[model samples]
Structures are given as structure tokens and as C-alpha cells.
Target: MKPEDFQFMSTMLKQRSGLVLNEDKAYLLESRLMPVSRAHNIKGVEELIAEIRKTNNEALIVEVTEAMTTNESFFFRDIKPFDMFKDHVLPHVLEKCAAKKSLRIWCAAASNGQEPYSLAMILKEEAAKLAGWKIEIIGTDISRQVLKKAEQGLYSQFEVQRGLPITLLVKYFDKQDDQWQIKPEIRSMVQYKYYNLLDSLTALGHFDVVFCRNVLIYFDQPTKGKVLEEISKLMPDYGMLFLGGAETVLGVSDKFAPVAGQRGVYALTGK
Candidate 1:
């Protein structure tokens, strides 16, 4: 691939999805976009770049962005966060919202629905406490493809094996041929939507809890701060944010601070 092509792609990706691709990932562009090119009957990455430049095709642009963004997910990934949600966040949010009798949770960059669904299962297990309350789990992702999979609520056997326990899997999922599908009740608890984290989040309204795990590491410092700041605005004083185990808000933004004794969990500053 030409240097110009690499630069164009990297810049476009950063602008469109906040994904920073350095020269070391030039090979990744070739490997990932080659299939997209072939599927569209384009010749190669060079030609793909030329076509995108010439036409500015919105569909093609979306395809390219979706191809580049990672959609890796599994149920209850990195267990500790969910443990915190159950043991800490949920009880606090429940008490805080007790008078309102409603709760809203957002799973940003929610790929294939696992994270939100995991929360749904947890909520289901606590049905007695939430008997008369309204609950909403909103799962959003930039990739429409993954959102479709999430809406379908289907998972392969291998997918179910990862990070999912036997008892919960048996209780919540029904075997459909070889793949397991989450029961409709649990599936109905979450709603999926197409969203880009870089875009304004006002229309989505407020959320009491957000899970934006493993997404900020791909962005540069400024983008990270911008996203964190925007997310902070969407939460109340007591709201909680869950990030990837490797990600943090220390240098990125002052809108949030690490929750005391909780790794990968953050609370709004001054709360």
C-alpha cells in the first residue's frame, strides 16, 4: 500500500470513528479492507481509496468504518466490573432512584449485546427487589452489523463458553441447533441502536450507569478526553462509569475520578 493511501485511511478512520491507526497498523488496513474491496468489486486498497475519494459514497464509507472497528465481546467479560455492578453500583442506583421507580443503563460500544445482556440477567436475578420498577438497558455501537447480531441475540457455542458460567447459560439461553440464543425475555430487556461515540449524545438522554469498556484505548488523548467529558454530561452526580481494565480517566479528563477501591470503575467528580 502507498504511504498516501495509508495516511488517507488513517485520517479518515480517526475522523469517522476516533480510531487512531499508526504506520505499524498499515498492514491491518490492507488485511481488513481487502475483503471490503473485493466484496464491492473494487480492485485493491489503492483503488478503494481512490473510489472513496472520488465518490464520497456514504454506504462505502460506513462499510469501511465498520470493517475497521473492533466488535470483540463476550458475556461477563473481565468479571470484576459486573461484580461491582451487582455488589455496589446497582444497590446504590436502586436506592438513589427509589422514589422515581425507574432506572436507565447505557452500554456504549456495546458489541453483540453481551455486556447489556449480562446486566439484564443480573437484573432478572434480582426480580423481587425490582418488582414494580421500570428498567431499561440501551446498547449502542457504531457498527450496524454488530447491532444486528445483538438484536438477534444469537451466539455460537464457543462464544457462550467464554466468560459465561454454566448455571446462568442454562437458565437464560435456549439451544437453537448448535448456537445458543438468549431467551426472549432477557433479549427484550435491552434495546440496540447505532451510535458513534464522537458524535453528540444529547438525544439519548441521561443514563444512571454506562459501560464503555475497552473502547478509549484506540483513541488519542484529546479524543479520549472529549469522549469522557461528553459521557460525564450524560450522568447524574451518583452515576457510575465502567471502562476497560487497562483504561483510566486520570490524565484524560477531570469530569470523573476512580471509584475508591474499584479497579476500572469511575464516579463523577465532586459526587
Candidate 2:
């Protein structure tokens, strides 16, 4: 891609999804957008950009943004967070909301359904503890394609194998054709939606725990702070934000503070 073309694409991605793409990442645009070009019968990224530039088509622009955005995920992509939830977080939430006997969790970037389903398994195991309680797990992603797959709750051999233990896999999944399908009970626990973090989250209401992990690293500092601010609004004072182990809220926003002794968890410090 040319310098001007790269700049246009970068600007478009930032405006549309808050993803920062530098000149060095031109290759990323070329590689990810090639599939979009082929799908639209455009010759390549250059031709696709030229056509979108000429027409200013909204649908085409969205398609390009979705294509460029990374959708990589796996079952319990990081192990420690889930462990923390089961060991520490859940007890605190239970104590805090003992009267209502309800809990809500939002998996902000629940690509293809693994993270939410993993939560579902834990919830199932603790069903006795949460008897007659209302548990709502909402999984949101910007990609409609991934939302569909998440709702289906089917996974390839490789996908299920990643981070999934053999015992739980046998208990929760059954062989269907070539892929493994999560049982309907687990599938029904999660609600998947096509949600962009850049958009309003008020429609989803409040959450006790918001797992917005491994996602903000793609944004620049300003965008990172903006996204964190948006997430903080949907959480309670006790609500916890889970960023990637490498990510932090130190200089980003005053809405959260690192939970003492917890590596990746941040406690809400602002409304």
C-alpha cells in the first residue's frame, strides 16, 4: 500500500473501531483485507480501497473493518483469570449480592464463544451453591460472523482441545459430525450479540463482573482510556475489570485501581 493509502486505511479503522494501525502494519491490512476484496470481487486491497474511496459505501467499509479486526480466541485463553473468578471473585460477588441471588457477567470480546462457555461450566459445577439464582452471561463481539458461531456452540477438534480439560470436555460436549457441540444447557446460558465497544453499552445495563480481557492492547493510549472509561460506566464499585496480563489501567483512567495481590484484575474506583 502507498503512504496516502495506508493513512486513509488507518484513519478509517481508527474512526470505525478505534484500532490503531501504523505504517509498519500495512502488511496486516494487506493480508486481512485480501479476503474482503476477494469476497467483493475486487482485485486486491488497493483496488478495494480505491472503490470504497470513490463510492463511500457504508456496508463495504464495515466489512473491511470487520475483516481487519482480529477475532482470535480459545477456550479459557488464559487460565489464571478463570481460576481467580472461581476462587476469589465469585465468593466476593456471592457475599455482596446474597439477597438478590442474581449475577450478571459480560464477556466483552467473546469471540466464537469459548470464554463464556467456560464460565458456564464453572457455573454449572457451582449450581448447588447458586440454587434458583439468576445467572446471565452476555457475550458480545463486533463481528456478526463470530456471534453466529458462538450461538451455535460448535467447535473443531483443535479448538476444543485448546485450554479445555479432558474431563470437562467429556461432561459438557458431545460429538456431532466432525466437530464438538456444547450441550444445549451450556449453550442456552450465554447470550451472544454483535456489539462494538465504541458504541453505547447502556442497553446492556449493569454487570457484576466485566471480562474485557486481551482486547485493549490494539488501541492507542487515548482510545484505550476511552474504552476503559466506557467499560467502567457499566460496572458497579465492586465490579472487576480483567485486562490482558500485559495490559494495565495505571495511566489510562482513574475509574479503576489494581486489586492488591491480583496481577491482571482491576477494581472499580470510580462510578
Candidate 3:
């Protein structure tokens, strides 16, 4: 609530998660983190800030960071990337990796598991095409809360309806009272992990395609460029990167260049 409190939280988020919270976003402290305060038995934002300052509690700090960073994601979000994956990207990557009989994909900023699960459905549909190939999909997020939801593979009707066609819904998900759970076959195709883009990605192994969508928009330019480079490094020369429709790597970094005909797709410049 106080200017000093706002500045403290804004700096803390930027340092911990690369989140850029402008002064105008001070209201988000109350809107997003009040529940965190309530959970810790703090009275209000002012009291919460006071407690954080007084105690310097690491767990409490983590809780506040995770609470503030919880973002919303729906299945097949924005639609076009998944369509592109099904129509063009898969066919190309399949041909390119056919000799190896394997392909690896990473979905960064993969909230609540929808994006990777959507890809899993596509893989399920293309089982015949990938008959002997080994497929691996890893979904990563900063929030452990959403990762748990993702691991459970459950979704409400509203979530399933958004950008997810009725056919795929009926085919890949089964009704569970009021919610739908992804079939085991599809759910088994993906793995979820706690990862921060700021952390070293060496342990995850190289990926043939990386979907770091809609995430960079929250970072300042320096952080954005840093994350883009980190992602590009994990990609092999022939690997592809899919960013959000509104995001671009043109001025941010030279690790990648826009693909010839794809809107949000980029390929290593090999520079």
C-alpha cells in the first residue's frame, strides 16, 4: 500500500522471478497476494509488508512470490500454434528426426498443463505417423500450485471448451462428475517440473522444439533477451521456438530469426 512497500515488492519480484511490476500495478499486491497474507494470519497488505520486512522469512517470501505469479492458461491457448504444430511443424520435425526415432519438446511457462496436454492429444492422433518413435514432452512452470493441477490432469467444462474442439474433448477426455480428466495414454506423454527461466536449463537435455509462449511479455527487455537466449541455446540448430502471437525475438536477440511463413515461429539463425 505504501510507496516503499510497493517498491520493495516490485524489486523482489523482478529479482526472484524476472517479473516487471510497474508502479501502477501496486494494486496487484492486494488483489493477488492478500490471500497469501491471510493464510499467514497477516491482517492486510500493510501488515504483510511489515511482517516480510520484520521477519525476512524465506518461506513466506516464496509464498508471496508464487501467489503473485500465478497466471491463467487454457487448453490450446490462442489455437494457431497448435494448428501449426499439427499441420506443418510436426511433419517437418518428423521427417527431420525420423532417423533417430525420437523427438523431445519443452513447453516453458506451461501453466496448469493445458498446453502440453493439448500437444499430447495431437501426438495421440498421430500415433500411426510416429509408430516407432519415442516422444517426450516436458512442461515447466514457476508455480507449484498449477503444476499439481497439471499433474492431476483435470479440467472444468469451461476450460475444456476454450479453444478445444468438441471432438478432441470427447475423444481424449472422460467426464469426471463436474470435471474432465485427460486419458492416461495422453497424460502419460508429458512430465511436469518446477523450473525458473533464470535457472540453468542444462539438466533438461536438448529439445527439438520449445514453446516459450506468452511468458516474455512479463519480463523487462534485459530479462526477456536473457530468457530467449537461454531457450535458444537448448534448441538444436534445426529446432523451432514458438513465442506468443504478440511477442517477437527480432530486436531482442539474434539467436533466432522469424520462420519464412510462420507468424510466431522462429528457427536458429546459426549465428
True lDDT of residue 62, candidate 2:
88
Instruction: Show where candidate 1 strays beyond 4 Å.
Output: none
Taking the tens digit of each residue's C-alpha lDDT, what string does model 2 give over 1-271?
Answer: 7888898989999999888898888899889989899999899999999998999999999889888888888887789889988888998998888889899999999988999999999999889899979999999998888889999999999999999999989999999999999999999999998899988888989999989887898889988888889888888777887888879999998889999877788898864
lDDT of each: 0.94, 0.90, 0.89
lDDT of 3 by residue, 1-271 (tens): 7889888889989988988899887888889888887887888888988888899998888888888885788888888888899998899888889899899999998899999999999898889998989999999998888899999999998999888899999898999999999999889999999999889888888999999998998899998888888888888788999999889997999999998888899999987
- Displacement of residue 104 (Cα, Å) in model 3 is 0.4
Against the hidden true structure, what lDDT does model 3 obtain? 0.89
lDDT (10s digit) by residue, model 1, range 126-223:
99999999999999999999999999999999999999999999999999999999999999999999999999998899999999999999999999
Can you give the lDDT of residue 262 in candidate 2? 76
**Model 1 lDDT, full chain set:** 0.94
Structural similarity to truth (TM-score) of each candidate: 0.97, 0.97, 0.97
Off by over 4 Å in 2: none
| Total backbone collisions, model 3 | 0
